[model samples]
Target: MKIFRKLRLQELLYNKKDKRLATAIKLMVGRKPLNLSLFKLAVKHSSAAEETKHGIKVSNERLEYLGDAVLGTIVAEHLFIKFPYRDEGFLTETRSRIVNRESLNQVGKKIGLEKIVESDLTEKGFFTHKSIYGDTLEALVGAVYLDRGYYFCRKFVLSRIISPHFDLDNIINTTINFKSKIIEWSQKENREVDFLLKSITGSQRFKEFTVELKIDQEFFTEGKGPTKKKAEQEAAKNACEKLKLAI
Candidate 1:
């Protein structure tokens, strides 16, 4: 039975499709994949979902869901160990910043994950759709977990994703509360700082807020975001950049 199974597996891998997927995954993960099917599903987008032999649809979404939880846990554990003296709020904020959509998208793109994503991005162009890369990044994590278990998956995330891509010092010291930072800077400089909501536009689901910052009665900068708080932060960040302030 063992001999037969080994031969069957060899035959399966000899097929062109399996070989291609196996090669791609090995390049991405820096190791050979045990189960090419799982990796295939990991790179598959929901738009390219197909029915299985049992009439069940399979896509990367389920793997993405699992990867999300796994990634969060690993990140939390990393932060906990890395910053033993930090508070819960600090850890949570750091984790959020690391795993935010934009960060994930940048990581995914940097790692060439978008090359393997099966999506019909003719209209908007693949580069324009950041979510695809981000989702694929999560799904790839799920695939690693399933094929190699949590230990190897955690190691891969740390060595390949976190260590290589992220600057730990920069992420830790990043000023998330830019509004507060600007306020403190203003107080130190004895300058009055104010954030004025200039305009609110778009529908409820797609609303945009524009905020303008005034420092000592002079218009410093303007920014826009999806929410008022975010707009204010963006404006503050712009102000910080304009003034060459170290955040």
Candidate 2:
């Protein structure tokens, strides 16, 4: 009797929590969630991850990885169909502009992820990372894929996320080659520019590269990414911002 009563109480508590989360999802995604636990896990940040008996931490990271692939595929297909005459390079660049960290972060905020995400970081610290919301957005995509299937997930991404937020023409027209801009500025100003590889970390499958940007042999900014070129691009973007060059 005691065990039965305890289990009943736990179920009731879970149901209550699920109810609240379901309401939030309906408002955000325009549909009621069928599997509430997936959505719950989607909002959980790595900083607030729970460890199990096997000493493995559980968070949104795995889902984020899955969602990243799915989102990329969906975006690639959409761009391909939308621009039949465009070359592969244009499709890739346009897709990057749509799915990049900064763009996703802004979209996440616009969709009210700030109120829904679960994190241990303070308000200011939470906002400082910039990637946290974007990561959560990807996790949410994974959850949607699992709960509603691929076709539904694609529709949600296109109708709810992409169509509402992005202006395709504007994104296509915008060129953001910060590395080229910085190099040109350096030449015109007669300043030496360099990108130095600082370090490489992480496992073989998931290596992260850190690069430092220097102008006239002085440290301007540092950036980290999955590849040296990406890290250098990030560093260059930061340096361009500092120099107030038109991006």
On TM-score, the leading prediction is 2
RMSD of 2: 9.2
Q: Write the residue-wise lDDT of candidate 1 on 1-247 in tens digits.
A: 4574445565464578778777777787887677677888998987788989999888999999999999999999999999999999899978977886778878999999867888766666654554788889999999999988999999989999988999989987766788888999999999999999999999989999999999888899999999999999999988876774644
Assess candidate 1 and give its lDDT: 0.85
Worst 10 residues of 1 by lDDT: 4-13
What is candidate 2's lDDT per residue for 95-164, written digit by digit as tens? 9889978778778988988888888888787656558888999999999999788999999999988999
Candidate 2 local distance difference test against the native: 0.86
Clashing pairs in 1: none
Stretches of model 1 off by over 4 angstroms after superposition: 1-12, 52-56, 125-129, 177-247
TM-score for all predictions? 0.68, 0.71
Q: Report lDDT per candidate.
A: 0.85, 0.86
Number of the top lDDT candidate: 2
| C-alpha positional error of residue 93 in candidate 2 after TM-score superposition, expressed in Å | 0.4
